[model samples]
Target: MHFDGSTWWMFYDGTSRGRRHVGLATSADGRSFTRHPRNPLVLDAGAVDVQRVGGVWVMLRESGTGTLWSTSPDGLCWVDRGRLFGLSGASTDRFGQVTPHLQVVDGVPSAIWFGGASVVSWNRNRIAVAYPDGAPAPAGSGCTACVSAGLSCAAACQSALGATGGACGMPGSTDGSRCCACAPEGCERCIGASADCHAACVSAGAAGGWCATPGSTDGSRCCACW
Candidate 1:
């Protein structure tokens, strides 16, 4: 029901064709759709468009398997960027689709998604949302810590288990100047500081102060964030 970059168009997918694909129809007006010569522009094939990058155009499809993206110049042919993100490496859930709801936030393309836990999101060329194993904390402000922990996080502050000095603030914020980690006093929270927070830690793989696990923190500790 959304318009193509120019003309009006309708998009549908993943049910009738026995494959995941995008069906397109043109309209002289915003209503009254007419199937275009190039109907079903995209098909189910394991590419970003087929089941990644969200509802064929929105930018937030979460298959629970992982987040993937497909790049295209004309919404015609697409290439797989491959697992743009996931909840946890140990995850096995598959909501069966990645709906990338891309939007410009402060003049930048940011993808919006809805699915399982550990689904983190960041903005740049486009907002990248994902988790590791399709576990908890997939979306929401906590994503920063969840993704930093490679999606194994159950809310850093909450995980502190109420220890006097263990728990911290919530996730989200702090990137490209965006805020991330919630202040220790439970005051302010970061909006896009997923990476910097990890980078500021003593080391990426350490068990103290913001570090999550190996391969998730620094290249020396965690996998070093893809």
Candidate 2:
């Protein structure tokens, strides 16, 4: 499905026999959709939703492990991004299927779960936002409002500078409105410049951008445009 901030759309295979691959459809209302083609839009994947991200691909396909166990620019591709962290291990499903958990807080994507084999070795479902020292704290518990959402106000401020062509490590914060305009890194814009950034933290035509990211100031970790 595609979410342009207002409408939700998708490509699905209607209920039938031997139905393989994707089909196109659009919806003004999320439930009912108009199918574009009766045949598969893109075929040859093992499962219907082998893997997919909302707004990053023309179609979906499941490649292999180590391909992208985590988030990347597009939900389909993963590579060198400015952000990196110590992923202790894949967060697993309660039944032990290795289904990790991910969420987007504020505007940054964060993974929260017990390092199963770590010191505590907890065996229960858990959800919390990240902390400055890389610890996990309950949501709404962080250095600032944005921090509670998994993004530091400093990163938010840096976003403001980047949007305006300022350099890193400078006093660049989102303008008075907390808008992190999509500009060059270390870029300098007015203190209150607007964040023309996509809801997922990238520009329209830039290379390597996150699409429909997780986490929100509202406490719902959904895949957002930024």
Which candidate number maximizes lDDT? 1
Looking at candidate 1, the ten consecutive residues that score lowest on lDDT are 118-127
lDDT of candidate 1 over 1-226, digit per residue (tens): 5554678755556455466665666677876777767755655632222222333433223454655566654555555566665543321122233344444446444433433332222211112333334444334464353334322232333233321122223446334122223223221132134333332332334322332352242334432233
The lDDT of each candidate is 0.40, 0.34
Q: What is the overall TM-score of model 1 with all chains considered together?
A: 0.42
Clashes of 1: 64
Model 2 per-residue lDDT tens digits across residues 22-54: 556667778887776444544433222322344
